[model samples]
Target: MKKLTCTLLAATLAGTFTASALAADYTFKFQSSDPAGDKNFQVQQAWADRVEKMSAGRIDIDLLPVGSVVKHTETLNAIKLGILDGHITATSYFSGKDPAFGLIGNTVGAWSDTTQLLQYVNYGGGYQLMTELYAPYGVKFIGGSTTGVESFVSKVPVNGVADLKGLKLRAPEGLVQQVFAAAGASPVNLPGSEVFTGLSKGVIDAADYTVFSTNQKAGMNDVATHPVQPGFHSLPLIDISMSQKKWDKLPEDLQEILTTSVRDFAYDMTTQLKIADQQAVKEAQANPNITIHNWSDEERKKFREIAREQWKVFAQKSPNAEKVYQSVTKFLEDNALL
Candidate 1:
């Protein structure tokens, strides 16, 4: 009887120790503007999962995606205020805080393929430039993921530049809006969550969101009759950011786990977006109600010209912009991309 009692006590003690250790583990919340099933949401979840597994559950991430608790445009400030812990944002969306954030997203243009977009942002010093730009705002930059080329979604068919003039369009970022204004289009600022409703109601005639997957998810297809391919925008580099205060509070091992997890997130998002874009195109083509508009060479040239001009204006705006421009230019030249 004494032996049995000793064994039971030992088991209880071991269980208590394990429970105590778990209770002492770190916990955090990850928030995003995208809802569940969003590519960014999936990527964020994958990252969280990777971190938890890698740390053996020493770090726990509670994911809140799709702006469930906060508005999409308010996510950055929310994180800064500690209202949320982390999130993924597009350069264009976040660029409202600083124009420099849009450089990477804008420079590549609609003709810039996914490879070009990734090369420009990752190897071209785009990420470092972006991180430095956001540092002053009390946010820690994790990295970015390309969303595939951005294209115009229109209710009216767009086969050439002439078709774009005077069109009321939803432009999320400052630089992108400027690009639209330069092209003689009316640029309106709106949140991602409102885009579909706005387009359906004719509140805006067009939108330049990244990739087909996002648009289809947003139900842009139902409202817009046409989608122009070889999108003028590149895969937008969605940024994964954490509040500086929370980041600094983490232990070195935890920080390492997070940074590594972010890299994994980037990879997952990039791969998923690539696959999504293809699937989206296939689905769009199959829909009889949707018209897939292909740009004429002349129209493509005109758009590229606008993009190049915008790049020059962008570089001239600030020293940081110039640095980012020079880095991207050098990278493009180095790889013979031009």
Candidate 2:
């Protein structure tokens, strides 16, 4: 009887130790703006996995896709209320809160590559500006990523700035629409859902949408025969952020792990998308119905010049917008991008 008692006590002690070892110190719930199958969202999941390993399982992130807990646009508010621990989303979704978000969300026509945008945000003043923009809403901005430069879709060939003269195209509202209009193109406001229909029915000639592989996969290339590669305009900013309150509870080392990991995530995402675009271009070239047009450096410069003029007009929308304009322009000028 005494032997049985000792065995049971030993088993109980071992079980307790195992449970204690497995229990996590922190488990964060992050909702991604991308759908479950989206390439970006998958990379986000990998990022979470890496964080768990880095923290030795003390930190575990449960990453959910869009609408898993709340609407995508509502995530900003949800995090403030502590309903969500963090989010991976486009800052433009909250542009309604401040014109600064609008300008910083996507500076439309400011970036031609992923490295330039990431450099501006990381080493330049963009990181500090993002913190200021988010803190007022109870969120801590971590880092930013992108889908690289988005390719343009058009049924007719648009080779240069000359082709934009009076051309009718579908574009997102605000800065993108305004920039296109300023460049002498007639910009139409249309939802993303209607882009294929609008293009197929001859309602518009071109649209500023997403990356090349995404468009090709969705049959966008089928209807729009002419696609401009190495797109000249619109590289959006995707933000990774957390509830400021929750972030304050984390240890300093954990905080650094999350921040540095996100920066690495951006580099991973950019490279993967670039490879996807290259493969899609190869497939697209094999098809006789499609024609790829890559803009020349000279043509891109002219369009950027037109875009810069509209930036000045948007800057006057609010005080925050003005600050963003000043910061962005200073960065551009310092980098010789101006």
Candidate 3:
């Protein structure tokens, strides 16, 4: 009987020790603005997986889908209030709070590819500017990535700038909307989840939502027959942010693990998105019902001219907006884009 008692006690003690060792050092509830089944969301999951492996399970991030715990636009506040540990979302969603957010979120018609934008943010002092911008909100800027050029999906053929006149389109709330409005098109602001229904119900004549792969996954091509290729207006920047309080509590090694992991993930996402976009474009062209058209250089030039005017208006919104605008423009000029 004494031998049995000793064995039971030893087993219980061993179990307790194992459980204690397995406990995660940090368990974060991280939400993303990407909807489930989208390529971006899948990539986010892969990012979480990589972080977990790199951290050796010391940090466990719970990845939630768009609107799972909070509205897409409300993630910043949720993170600040501690309702969520962090979020990966488009920076433009907070443009209403500060025009600087939109200017930094996406500099419409400023760059021809994602690499330029990434370089500007990672090495051109953009990270410091963004960190300063979000400091007042109690959020920490971790890192960011882009979805590359989006397709302008429309029911009607938009072969040139003239086709946009009087056309009703759905655009994100920021520089893109203003640029579209200036080009004689009526721009409506809507969440990405509602875009397909808007197109199906005849509510919007056209939409500029996401990368070609994501749009195809969302089945946007079925509803919109004419999609403009090499989309000219916008390339959105998606950011990873955490609560300042949570960030401050992390150890230096953990912080390095997270930041580096996110940066590498950003590069991976950009490459995957670009490759997927090519496949989507090829599949779209082979479909008989879909018609893909590219805008002429003159049309693109006209759009860029209008975009510059909108940039001036955006810069006038606040001092910070002006600062971000100047920084981006200087980067463009240095790169020979301006």
The estimated TM-scores of all candidates read 0.86, 0.95, 0.94
Q: Summarize candidate 1's per-residue lDDT along 234-291 as a digit string, tens digits.
A: 4566777788888888889888877767666766776787788788888888889999
lDDT of each: 0.74, 0.90, 0.88
As for TM-score, the candidate ahead, 2 or 3, is 2
Model 2: residues with Cα > 4 Å off, grouped in runs = none
Clashes of each: 9, 0, 0
Higher-ranked by lDDT: 1 or 3: 3
Question: Over the stretch 93-209, how does candidate 3's per-residue lDDT look in tens digits?
Answer: 888889999988988877668888889889988888999999988999998888878778899999888899998899887788888999999999887779999999999999988
Candidate 1 RMSD to the correct structure:
2.9
* CA error at residue 300 for candidate 3, angstroms: 2.6
lDDT, residue 1, model 3: 100
Q: What's model 2's TM-score?
A: 0.95
**Colliding residue pairs in candidate 2:** none
lDDT of 2 by residue, 101-166 (tens): 878888988998888889888988999999998988899999998878999999989999889878
